[model samples]
Target: MNTMTVTKSVVMITEEASFRIKEMMEHNEEQDAFLRISVNGGGCSGLSYGMTFDQNSQENDVLDEQFGIAIIVDKEDAAILEGTKVDYKQSLMGGGFTIDNPNAIASCGCGTSFKAAARPAEEQPCE
Candidate 1:
């Protein structure tokens, strides 16, 4: 059973990030897909963020739309991701998406893994 709650500003997506994501969706031919953001256990810093294009929503998923894009976040992860901001940066070297999470107390050197203030840190060797 999938339940959706329309949230206001649960996650912030910058215009640059939206443009890049839209371009990627078009390139992958997944225009109808929803961008799902999830927090999973077992990163070097107890929590890790995952993003993928999902065609369908799962049980207890919260839905939000921004910059002409549909976004979903699992109910279980809402708290950890609340007030998070997603941005894309371009430099002479390269370009990539960066996440600014207020709940994250510490993040690994890799930048994808983080330790939330409400969660205990679990250190694991990065594979």
Candidate 2:
């Protein structure tokens, strides 16, 4: 595996996030699957994040290992995701995953969408 340490990771995953993801994977019976993070077009803020457990990786994927969990990010999305942090937070309302991307210049109120600093031209209004 071409896994990298957290210090050199393109996207940092916090311990809390790792624990939550591991729990989900175990519950879903996908213990050996890799956590794949991707950027996709079409959101209130021009881009959105996707997370899934992938059993296979593509040729251009970047692999990282943090907290004993395998993480994969597509090469094309690396530039926009660089320095991004994934964290899990708990509150009276409940718990959820949060993403903080250094490249994001704007984000919608929904929080799942963001506009990358270099992709301002791609921004679209919410429908």
User: Which candidate ranks first by lDDT, i.e. highest?
Assistant: 1
Q: Which parts of model 2 are misplaced by more than 4 Å?
A: 1-7, 119-127
Please report the TM-score between candidate 1 and the true structure: 0.90
Residue 25, candidate 1: C-alpha displacement in angstroms: 0.6
True lDDT of residue 64, candidate 1: 93
Number of the top TM-score candidate:
1
Mind giving the per-residue lDDT tens digits that candidate 1 earns over 1-127? 1346667667889999999999999999999898998888877887898889999997678899899888999887888899999999999999999999999989998777999877676788887
lDDT for each of the candidates? Answer: 0.87, 0.86
lDDT of the structure predicted as candidate 1: 0.87
- At residue 105, give the lDDT of candidate 2: 87
Worst 10 residues of 1 by lDDT: 1-10
lDDT of 2 by residue, 1-127 (tens): 3444333588999999999999999999998898999898877888998899998877788888889888899888889999999999999999999999989888888776888866554656776
